[model samples]
Target chain A: MLQSIIPLAVDALANAALIFFVAVGLTLVFSVLRILNVAHGSFYSIGAYVAASVGLWIVGAGLPDWLTFPALLLSAAFVAALFGPIVEKTLVSWTYGKSEAVQVLVTFGLFLILEDLQRIVFGIQSVYQDTPMTMLGISEIGGIVYLNYQLLLIGLAGVVLVALRLFITRSRTGRLLAAVVADREVSEALGIDTQRMFMIAFTLGVFLAAIGGAMATPTTGVAPGLGADTMVLAFAVAAIGGLGQVEGAAIASIIVATAKVLAIYFAPSLDAVAPYLVMLAVLLVKPYGLFGSGSTRKI
Target chain B: MAHRTSIKTLLAATALVTSASVAVAQDKPASLDVGVFTFMSGPAAAYGMPGRQGAEVVIDMINAAGGIDGVPISATFVDEGQGAEGVISEYRRLAEEPETDFMIAALSSGNCLALAPIADQMEMPTVGWNCDSHQLFADAEHPYFFRPNGNTIAEFMAYVIYFLDNNPDVERVAIINPDYSFGHDAAEIVKASLAAFKPEVEIVAELFPKLGSSTYQTEVSRLSAARPDVIFSNLWGGDLENFVRQAAPRGLFRQSQAVFALGESSMNNVDMPEGVIVGVLGDGWWRSPDAAELGAPEFAEAYQTKFEKAPVFPAMKMANAFMVMKAGYEKAIEANGGAWPTDEQLTAAMEGMTIDTLTGSMTFRADNDGIVDQVVGMVGSVEGIEGPVLTNMVRYDGDAVLPPEGEDPMAWIASLTPDFIAAMPKPGSYE
Candidate 1:
């Protein structure tokens, strides 16, 4: 039992690490921008595609293998830098003061366009670059062999959580973003440039989602529908974590991952619906989620 | 001013066409129009794009060789990732347009089933390039729909017989297949085959994960926990690739013997670990002895040159589908005294026809199911090859696994005795 538990925990943490990045980014965007980026998942897939492309290029060019590690991060940053401001300024900015329905519809349209763009750019084949995974090597934990890259991901998720907390509480830009989230009209009245904050928040959201996708590419193969699948899962995590709660997303990711892992271990039939089942159970118990409440914004 | 000019431009174009038509009498278009359907998006595209690429190569080859009856074949490919309803809508839209003579309809069994009835209604005389499900012809037979690949029953039962021969001492088995009718039906056939061959065997675990699922971490854990002697999966395309990737790192292969029915299709794309059981659903392996013997080396070399990788089973299947199409046309033309046969004549020619493919001979059964050999083998590293390849292979006869005509497959398996296994060929016999 102990041997099995160790591997299960490791698997759960690895699963949660990927889920946390996408979900927290989604929640953060919702909190500050006050509009759900239905296209957030597209950024994830785009990040993966960029990372795989870069890694493949590095390999094809006969460059040093160690460069693959940096390629992952560079790929995520490239996607965030390229897509973030353009999408936010040109398209997402229009949804700033619009209704939720309009925001969703517009972003969904963007998702469709981005999906087609990926097909045109990457073609309709599964792209994989596991050089980073292989480079990190393997370790035995709890009687089961695991990729060290997976363990690094869990640690990275922890660092991101701490770094985000510090940014929101201790940093000037973070304070301005929080002010905008609290009261957009008041922030504008104070001449705080809430529009800029919305752009920054949305861009940061794209960065986080892209990083999640980049990190996941080492373990999971990237394909055409990856963005949509990630989007649906991220939505579930965000909803269960209380739409705009960063900490809620963190806890909810673990909860959802644990549920899925448990279902896979014990009842294989429920593996697919395990996360939603947990969400249903939790939502039934707490209408606003565990950490989510209609009060001052919390993590 | 621009709008008026555009209208005047349209009138000028109409005048130019009228003058050109008068100058040259009636002539057929330079290229034959075909609407090809396969997966071009999503996880299924991992399998479908290869089919599309094969079509591109074969169509080019045909056009280069002066095409069929001297008409160049040009295709408009449709992505099956857009769900069945969209597929039906696209099929209807394409059918309504003139110039689409034949269709290689789908790769998904569900989509093929959906399109089969509609093909009959439209009188399109479509060919199913990769439809493996037996249920497509269960109750209703579509006159215009034809399959030149054997059904799921034949494919899955071949695995069962091969495994039984290879591991005569095996007692426990487990299945982890995609969560759909294809997966479930495969499980049923495998179980039935086992029950018929060795009733003492116990099924310890059966898992069905959703299609397009990226992570199989939990599935690996479950299958590991079960500790069955043998683990079987029909997860194909990206799902199979994902499972193999996840499971390889976790030591699942070291713990239990694994059987991936569609593993051969992914041998070159992924690093499939050594010693796992793998097979092409039909005899579509480009390097199979039959393929090597029957002028398939040229096709294989051309495919590799064009696609940058060796042709997998899906590519072979797609190429074979074109071959079948070409054969049917030739037979129809011959029967019609060297003239273009109507769609009806082509359909008649395809009925119960036997055509030799690159890998093996395929004979379409009266029930619209094609009978083809099933090749099963274990993965091993080849010295000269860049990656792992199948070794210790067994080629199961198609008729050995197929249910008798006009009989329910499940019922037939239930009535079989241990004598059936005793009579079947053993592993490595084909070589």
Candidate 2:
């Protein structure tokens, strides 16, 4: 049992690490903004595209190979800085106090526009940059060769989860954001800058998604239709984890990834629909998700 | 008396004009419109765009050489990436137009299956350019539809033969293919071929990953755990690129004899390791001696001058389809006594037609399925080319591998024997 379980665990954690990055960001934005940002996955793909471009430029320009590591983070920062505020101010802000359908439709429109824009800027062919992946080298686990870059991704995801926990609890802005989540009207009455909180939360969500996509550049190709695939998978994770629950998102990612890995190992036919099967089963038992309840209407 | 004579004279002139036009047709039109379908956007574009470029370059070459028998060819390229419904609708709309003469139908097997019947229904001479699905003609035969390339059964069996001959002591084999008809059909063929030649071969693992899947970390792990002696995959385009990038560093290729059935297309794009087995699905290798002798090298050079990249197999397949169509028209015209033929005449001409292509000759069987040579090779860094090129090549005769008409393809594969393979050309003998 242990022999079979080791490979499964390693594969699940590695897969979950990639999913957790985008899912948590999507959940975070939904929790704070009271709107499911359909365009969150677009930021993730944009980050991947930018990271691949920068990493390729670094290698082409004769820069130190180690710089590719920082290039990933820098690419994410660039995407978040450019797209976060502008989208939040124009599209996201307009959907405030609107019905869920309206908000979803509007962000869905934004998603379509971003998808076309990516095609125009990046062209139809896939973009790949694996300098970081190759530089980090390889390691063997459970008699299977694994990418050390993959191990790094697992560690990075853990670090992000912890850092997000600390930021939401210890920081001053964190307390304000928490208060707004608790009661937006009362937070405003208590002289908290709710608008600023909204912007900060949305930007943070964008940053998380962009970083996820950037980090994935070393393992996957950045191409058209990647954003939509990521978005659908992220939505599954977000739903399974209970919407707006950061820790829930992390745990849900593991469950979903585990399901997918198990399917690939034992049942290859169910590989594509494995995550959704888990979602269906989880949603059946707990209609509001594992960590969700009827009373958590703060969003 | 004058009115009666006038009526009789008019009747006589009308009858004469009708009878005279039947024997001597009008001159060829100023330009011919071709409906070309391929994926122009999205993930599949990685493969489909090459086919599109080949069409563009071939059309340009044809026009430069004074067009197809003096009629300038104009093409309307349709993006087949937009699902089968849209593809069928586009074909119907284009077929409805009297100006559109022929259709280079599609790059996808699914789209080809959908458009095949429609071609016959509309009396359009359509070629299945890049579609290799055997299922396209399994149940129904389209009079107007034809494929100038080899089918999946022969394509997959060639890989199995090569692998078995090289690794006689192989115990376990694995498969990782995309989750679609093309992928599933190839898997069936490979397994059947294995059972036929080497009954003791064990298929340790089989995985069907979703098309356009970005990551294969888990699939890689599963495959590694299986500890197979050989691994075969037919994943192409960006999916293949992603798999190569992820699996190479983990020593998958080094550990196992990796056989990428469609790897030739991405040999230029990916940093593929030498000694990995790859094939072009047909005799589309531009660098193959046969192709070079047949002027494929010149076509490739002209293609590179126009598209800025050397032609891959998809490009070769599309270009060959154009050649086959042009040959059909010329044959039809010849048969019609120096006059342009109708759609029915072209269909008749394509039936049981044999024509020389850039790669080799394609002879259309009575079933409208063409029998072309299958070429398989291993990646080697040739001194002349900038990137890895196919070496240790073997070209299998299509007639020997292809199932006879009206026979079940799987049963035909299962009947193949080791003695059967021994009589064929060995690897590295093509040169």
Clash totals, every prediction: 2, 0
DockQ of 2: 0.90
Residue lDDT tens for model 1, B1-431 = 99999999999999999876543332344666778899988898888888998888888788888898787888999989899999999999887777777889889999999999989998887889998898988888888898888789989888887788887889999999999999999999999889888999999889998999988876776677677888989999999999998888778888888999999888777888888899888888777788888656778788889878877888889988888888887787788767666777888988898989878899988877788988888888767877777788878788888888778989998998878877877766765
Colliding pairs, model 2 = none
lDDT tens per residue, model 1, A1-299: 89879988988998999999999999999998888899999999999999988998999999999998898888888888899889999999988779999999999999999999998999878999888888888887876677888899999999999899899989999988888878888989999988789889988999999999998888889999899988988988988989778888999999999998888777878988989988898889978777777776654
- Those runs of model 2 whose alpha carbons end farther than 4 Å from true positions after fitting are A297-299, B1-27
- For model 1, the stretches where C-alpha displacement exceeds 4 angstroms are A61-64, B1-32, B381-386
Error of 1 at A140 (Å): 3.1
- Residues A54-113, model 2: lDDT tens digits: 999999999999999999999998998899888999989999999999999999999999
For candidate 2, lDDT tens digit of each residue in B98-158? 8889999899999999989899888899999999899888889899999998899989999
Instruction: Indicate the docking level reached by candidate 2.
Output: high
Alpha carbon lDDT of residue A114, candidate 1? 96
In candidate 2 chain B, where is summed lDDT lowest over 10 consecutive residues? B19-28
> Candidate 1 versus the native: TM-score?
0.92
